[model samples]
Target: MTRIGFRLALAYRSNIIMTCVALVAQVFLLRMIWTSVYGSRPAAAGLTLDALLAYLTLANLQAFVTHTIVSRIIHDRIRTGMVFFDLARPVGYLRQMAGFQAGNTLGGLLLLAPVIPVVLLVGSITVPVNGAGYVITLVLGYVIAVQLALLISLIGFWTMEIGAVSLLYRLVSQFFAGTMVPLAFFPGFLGVVAEILPFKYMGYVPAAVYVGHISDISGPVVVELAWIAGLWGLLVLTWSRAHRRVVIQGG
Candidate 1:
């Protein structure tokens, strides 16, 4: 399944190209916006222009790499009555989805290889303060993202259409996840809200760690692990109920 997903992603040349183009465009556009905001200033919000740009660049790339279509795929399969075949397989359905998403993420990472250099050149992005910490937190962030996506996909079990729900999730997650702006700029209650939410682990935490906004990764890592554990428990319970629903409906 992983290989199949990787091959499918690679085969979709137009998608890869368009995604890269869009990412590049977004990087430059964001640079312009931030430059204007920082006019004649070296830093604001405790982050230098370069560091802030780096954070945005890495956050955008991470968001793109972690993107998942699992919800849409699950919804379509359920609607077409094809999901039961997956349930009957020896392998667990969630495991299979995770494997495919992993492959898809790898494909996205590959697609970003060239684009990364372009953005780095244009943005003068700073190197990660703690390379090892960045790597560890980023991987943890990916795991958290996958689990969150799976939880969303599980909604397909009850809903006939998940498009609206998925869209709402994307919008909310993107905003709170710090893909559009760093949580540092969220302001008062909004900042407090973002800090408490799991969404920050998806984009903000890892990027902040990379750019040195998060000097100590220990706290964020612990929070991420806690969220991962809690989310997994929720996922297990949800999947159990979803499985029973599928069985009853199929009967």
Candidate 2:
């Protein structure tokens, strides 16, 4: 299944390239925005300007790396009655979806190689304080992201199409996941709210860990693992219910 997904991802090379370009442009724009905002202040909200850039850069990469194409793919399958074929297959539906996401993430990381240099040159990307922990947290962040996307995709079982809901998911995730602005920038109450939500594990936590904003990694790691377990349970429950209710219409 992973091999199949890898091949499928290879077919989307052009899309990956475009994504890299867009991410690079985003890094550039963010660099400008944050630089202007900092404007000689050494630090704000416990993050130096360099730390902020590192956070944004890593957050964007997390966003891109964890992006799931399965929602669109599954939506089309459902609409065309092809999802039934998947259901009939011997492979576990959840495992197949996860394998595909893993493969796609590998492809995204490959594409990221080019963008990293640009970000490094312009954004002043820095090494994480806890290099090993950062790597681990980074991988966990991508896993959390994939799980979130899968949950959104599974909604297609009821909606039969995810176009509108997918857009809504992206917007909500972007804000709550701290891609728009660091959670540190949020007011006290909102920051607390964000911390409790799983979205923070998707980007903010890992980015903070990378930039040394989070000194003790155990707390965030434990919370993130708990969220991952919670999300997995939700996915299992939702998929079980949706699979039973599925009634392919029109095709």
Candidate 3:
């Protein structure tokens, strides 16, 4: 499944190119915005201009790498009745999806080879404060990302068409996940909301750890582990329900 996903990702050469182009453009655009905002000020919210730029660059790259289209896959399969074949397989549906997503992530990593240098030229990014801790949390972040995507995808088992729901989820999750801005910059109730949500662990925590915004990863790592356990349990329950609710449309 992983090999299949890698091949499938590479098969769409145009998509990979366009996505990289878009991400590069986005990085530059955001850099300009942040530069203007800083406007000679050294730092805001404990983030210096350089640190903020690095955060933006790394966060965007991480977001791109971890992004998944599992919901779309699930929706299409369910719509076409191909999902029935997935159900009949010996492997657990969630495991199959995870394997494919892992491969897709590896493919994204390969595509990043060219983009990384471009971003690096744009600005300086800091080395990880805790190399080992950064790696552990980043991997944990990927798992949380996949689990969240799978949970959202499972909604298609009942709704049949999850385009709107999936879009909304992406928008909300990205915003709260610190893909756009760091949760540290979020004010008042919004910051509180982001803190309580699992989304932060996906993008923010990992990038923060890399940028030194998070010096002690012990707490965040613990929270991430707890979220993983909790989410997996929820996924199991949801999949069981979705399994029974499957309705084949046009086979």
Which candidate leads the pack in lDDT?
1
lDDT of 2 by residue, 84-203 (tens): 888888997888888877876776677677777886767688767878888878777778888888888888887777899999988888788898799999998988888777787778
What stretches of model 2 exceed 4 Å from their correct place? 247-251
Against the hidden true structure, what lDDT does model 3 obtain?
0.84
User: lDDT tens digits, residues 12-60, model 1?
Assistant: 7579879888888898899899989999999888988888899998888
Alpha-carbon shift of residue 251 in model 3 (angstroms): 11
Q: Rate the local accuracy (lDDT) of all candidates.
A: 0.85, 0.82, 0.84
The Cα error of candidate 3 at residue 87, in Å, is 1.1
- Model 2, residue 142: distance off in Å is 1.8
lDDT ranking from best to worst?
1, 3, 2
Q: Estimate each model's TM-score.
A: 0.96, 0.94, 0.95
Give the local distance difference test score of model 2.
Answer: 0.82
Worst 10 residues of 3 by lDDT: 242-251
Query: Given candidate 1, what's the lDDT at residue 227?
Result: 89
Report clashes for each candidate as comma-separated counts: 0, 0, 0
Q: Which pairs clash in model 3?
A: none
